[model samples]
Target chain A: MPHRTEDIEIGLLLEALYQRYHYDFRHYARASIKRRLLQARSHFNMSSVTALQERVLHDPEMLPRLLGFLTVQVSEMFRDPSYFRALREQVLPHLRTYPSLKVWIAGCSAGEELYSMAILFREEGLLDRTLFYATDINPEALKAAEAGIYPMDRLRKFTENHQKSGGKSSLSDYYTADYGRAVFDKSLRNNVVFSDHSLVTDAVFAEMQLISCRNVMIYFDRGLQDRAVGLFKDSLTRHGFLGVGSKESLRFSRHASAFSEFVPEEKIYRKREP
Target chain B: MSAPPDRAVVIGASAGGVQALLALLPSLPADFPWPVLVVLHVPADRSNVLAGLFEAKCSLEVKEAEDKETVRPGVVYFAPSDYHLLIEENGDLALSSDEAINYSRPSIDVLFESAADAYGERLVGIILTGANNDGAAGLAAVAAAGGVALVQDPAAAYARTMPQAARQACNAALVLSLERIADYLKGLKAE
Candidate 1:
């Protein structure tokens, strides 16, 4: 079958993005990326993806805007509350034995999961000893995450999720509402480090006690998924916990044997002592 | 006229979806040649039991779709409750936590549009009984991509707004009742 003209245009666009900007999305899943690029094309009022690519390549300002479309930022605090609950009830006890803890929130878009983890650690009496690393490839998302503010409307659900995750304190204690926004307390991020990192291209930067990289891998193809999981395996300390999205699993990964299913239902795995 | 050799069939239903699916799906023979993907509006908070419910009654294997799983024939893949299910160009299934479209997560449009892109003219898209206009644009996309679009006859639907909206969106879509739609599907040959 002949390639659709739109698909050919998308390939050229992705190539242009790699050649002009250092951002690499070539290994990302094709169908969703194609949809996103088409959405971007429509938003820019361009006739096709090639036109969008031409504009992006010529105008440096368009790179960031186009990057926003290429990277998915959809996330919620305490998403799949059961996963957090499992961390609280089952995983925390194991982490508490360590003198100090380093937790990595890989692909931490808008810092929702990072904030969730910080709050969870604080409630569990582990925050003071914990240093959180929040990383993402999108600079806009990293900035938003560093600000730790969210729309006021989203707080109710966050609060409910926190409670459902067996949060030990009031969710209100962490954020102040102002001008239709919830400004999370700056103190919550006292030990947090926000950085620009890409699982697609960058190497692991730290040996972490817990790494929560949820829903980020679904965008990657099988080979990229293996690379990311291998990085997770290498970055984790022996017996460290790694949590992924509820629907994602290590069952198909080549690195699956390096970790044991710590909480099978929640998709939490523990690195084997090597 | 006989239907083209379809590589896959995608069905979208809501409002009275379960009953409609039960009536339509169980009629599929165990050796049905193409895969069937379904998107039925379900609440995000509750755990999905739709796959299990259908598996007990259907002849083909039925299960919730997983990320990166390869699409297989002779199976019915139901979109999970809170994630959008998409078909990759390589025919692997992908799940996205992207914001809901048309007020739905496992949105009918998301599935149909993606599948239309993946399979092109070798796809069959069907819109069953529903209350909202979610699947209308998706069926239009299918028709635009040269895939067959079939809408339940509004008069025969449990809720007419959905089918009526779909028919309006894709004027070329065949308007058929539940039994006729099933018969049409049964008549389809493997690619």
Candidate 2:
């Protein structure tokens, strides 16, 4: 299969990038890597992939731009209303048994998901006893996640999503509107520590009862996916739950037999009690 | 940044959706090349039978979207049946309390626009069966931004108004039958 030679050039460029910056995307799936390279081309307006790669490898500052292009960030608050619902109904009860809890929202891009989980924990009578670590590789997203400010107009929709996702009270109760922005309640962060971490190239930090990685694994190849799943498997406590995106599964995965279906329909799995 | 196109797929649904999705999703197999994001607008409440149903039907791993999560391929991420889903610049997920557009917070527009901004021409937006016209304008935005715009033939959609609105708003690439739409996506992976 002859891939566009431009793809070959981009592959070399990524290798060059790793050599210089030490960021390893060599394990990321080729399609996504190819896609990100294409996005970088347009951002720089080069004639072809080779030109784009040439310029990026030569210019040091351009690496950040390339990195941004590579990480096509997408996220939301309390995204799948039901996964949290399941946590609330099924998992939270057991979590409540602990005197305190350590939860990790791995690959938390801009922090909306962490905030959502925090809100859930707060409402579930666990916020005071909870400690959350929202980690991501993108520094820009980490800063925004730490700031916790979002477009004000989005609050109404989020409120609706919140209500529909089994939110116990008015969504308005979570944040205050100022001008055109919704500044989330500062209290939500009291227990949350937003930092920089990469599922691709970093080591796991803590054991957690719930690790909600959502859609972060799609960019990875089968090997990297298994590595991250292995990290999640290692990070989770006994019978802890691992939640992934709707289209992702443990089936046919290297880690497939490691977990059991808890809410298989929802993509929620419990680490097999080994 | 001079590379050929990299296509990504986005899907939106609402109202009588569980069944609609069950019918539509089983059509998408696992190992579909591009990443697909599903926004199903279920009223904010306890959601059930969604992730599970799709999990069983679709070969891809089907689960709800999470905040700040990056998009992944061969995976079908449904909007958490309540909240609106969006894309972040860093390629992570963005969940919001942002007010609803078209009367729904997890409005199809929110997902479509965010995805449009992120993926641009590489993005493929699909407005599936839904009661409201939430995804219509957003689908147009995707088309206008150089993304591929596809809608289930309104006549074939479980909810026709939304697809009709999409066709009216944009120069859609394909107005496909529900089952045919699946075939079209399969072709994308092959490409």
Candidate 3:
């Protein structure tokens, strides 16, 4: 099919999806969505995006299978060392005021970032006091997150991050590299409760001292971003901190007024009274 | 009959991406069977010219990723500036602002490693070039998770250090120069 027709088919398919599935992707930006659908058109061995959408609407199995292709998950353990450093240097002091801590790692695909937090808590002597809730909508990724088995070899690089993030101990002490993979110490993830939660469809469940929702808001539109931010603000205790991805900020959001910048460079913010 | 599952190719580039992407993307045949996901490290906050840069280069199709977008195999997926583009289990694109890794939100490691987890053996992870040791560990994870790992030849890469880092972490099942890598991908059902 010509490129123009392909794009047209994509729009129609999205409409069909909204009507049939009741999943509102209509508000999502177009170029990327169309690009993904166009790829799907060929991926499912269909002739066009419209045809691919048609199959998904009728075939129960197809939607879930196609759902697999639609998801683009990329993350690592201790991804941004600086954020952890900020948690240690600045946020920890403030967090110590509370008797116990509730830390949420939202959209924690496969749990790398959550485990990183676990390690940080353990090192900071906050692990016992910390109760982590790692949530994601992806079941497969969530299962992996619960398992806490990261590739053993990535430890070397994560080790560098650990060092740069002002790690106090040798990075190797945390995990044992066995079976050509790094099995992180089970003790670190003990307090972690990995579950399925959606920022698009879910609401606040608990009061948290720190909400580490990195890399999640970028998928949401401005409205959805605000909704999620509002939830974060609602969930956080006063003076609680929120850490977002560097590319993401609360600078212009509705909730922007509710927080003061903690380590602005590291994208850490503290929730203020609304 | 239903068409075959589109082969999805995710390309991770750094340091010399402008040249590498231009060279590699053009080599991919027009109407290739899978979408290509490209992550090239650029200075954060700058406009990533990749979409415009590679729009005409021998194209299956080229575009940047967006939040909550579904990903397909035939279209090429490029990481936008300063954001980590991830795959949801639903097989959709989820853009992230969590933080930077190796000083990059759209770090090659972030993309490759996640894609590795998402696609498993069906996935192919390619590390073209870069100065930092960003994608090496991720590529190793990809290979470990049963995805094929491709590294451009350090000798030929504009930035040999990045390729060498990747090569060190994994055996680098395939090491090729621009032309050879291009040929290898062209022969693939998906990249």
Candidate 4:
């Protein structure tokens, strides 16, 4: 069968992105990425992916706009309550034994998961001892995550999720809602270090007690996914926890043997000692 | 009869979807040549049991679609509740947690549009009983890609709005009852 011209254009565009900007999305899961690129093409009012590629290659301003589309940022605080609940009831007990803890929130899009973890830790009396490394490839997202503001309307769902995750404190204690925006408490992120990092192109930077890299790797192809899992295995301390998305699994990954399922239903794994 | 031998089928439904799927999917023979992908709107907060529910009834293999898994013939893949399922050009499955479209995360439009891009003319898109218009644009995309578009007849559908909107979106789509749609699929031959 003949290859689609659009697919060819997408390949060229991804290649241009990597060679020009060093943002490697060339190994992302193709279908969703293609859909996102098409959305970007339409958003830019470009006639085709080829035209979009040419424009982005020449104009530096267009790269960030395209990056916004390429990066998946849709997230909710305590998005999957059950996963948080599992972390609270099962994982935290093991983590509490350590005097100091480093938790890595990989792909911390807009700070939802990071904030959720902070609140969970605070409630569990682990806040002062824990340091969070919130990282993402998108600088814009990292900045927003650091700012820690969200629409006020979303708080209801967040509150419900908080309660479901066995929240001990009122969700209202964390943020001040005003004029359709909720500004989260600054102290919640006092120990957080937000930085620009890409699981696709970056290496492990810290030895973490818990690494929550949820939903981010769903966009990766198998090879990239394996690379990411391997990175997680390397970053995690022996018997430390690694939590993936509820739907994502390390079962088929080459690095699967490095971690054993800790809470299999919640997709939480424990790094095995070498 | 004019359908391509190496075709794939995508079906979208909501509201009365479970019953419609049970009635339709079990009719496929064990040796059915093409893979069947289905999306049904369900609550996002809970685990999806749709695959298990259908596995006992359907003759073909039934499982939830996993990210990056190769799409195989003779299997029925259901989109997980909280994620949108898409088909890659190489026929692998991809899942997305992007913002919901038409108030649904596992949006039928997402799946159908991606499948149309993947399979093009060798794809069959079906819209069944649903109260919402989520699949209208998707079925139109399928038709635009030269794929066969099938809509459950509004009069026969448990909920008529979805089929009505889909029919309006694609004038060329065949409007058949659930039974007739199954018969047409059963008539399809392997490549």
Give model 1's DockQ, 2 decimals.
0.75
Which stretches of model 3 miss by more than 4 angstroms? A1-24, B1-191
Scored by lDDT, the top model is 4
Model 3 lDDT per residue over A221-260, tens place: 6678888899999999988989998657786588899999
**lDDT, each prediction:** 0.91, 0.76, 0.76, 0.93
Using lDDT as the measure, name the better of candidate 2 and candidate 4: 4
Whose DockQ is higher: candidate 1's or candidate 2's? 1
lDDT of 1 at B12: 96
Error of 2 at A145 (Å): 0.6
lDDT of 2 by residue, A195-240 (tens): 8788877887888988888867766666788899998998989988
| Model 1 C-alpha lDDT per residue in residues A154-251, reported as the tens digit of each score | 99899999999998899999999999999999999999999999998899799999999998998899999999999999999999999999889898
True contacts kept of 4: 0.82
Expressed as tens digits, the lDDT of each residue in B1-191 for candidate 3 is 34434235677778887888788788777767766788888776434677876787756677878665567656787888868777643466667554577787677777776666566677778888888888898789788867888889898888888888999999845787878877877787643
Docking class of 4: medium
Best by DockQ: 4
In terms of docking quality, model 2 is incorrect
- Please give me the total number of clashing residue pairs in predicted model 1: 0
Ranking by DockQ: 4, 1, 3, 2
List candidate 1 segments past 4 Å from native: B1-6
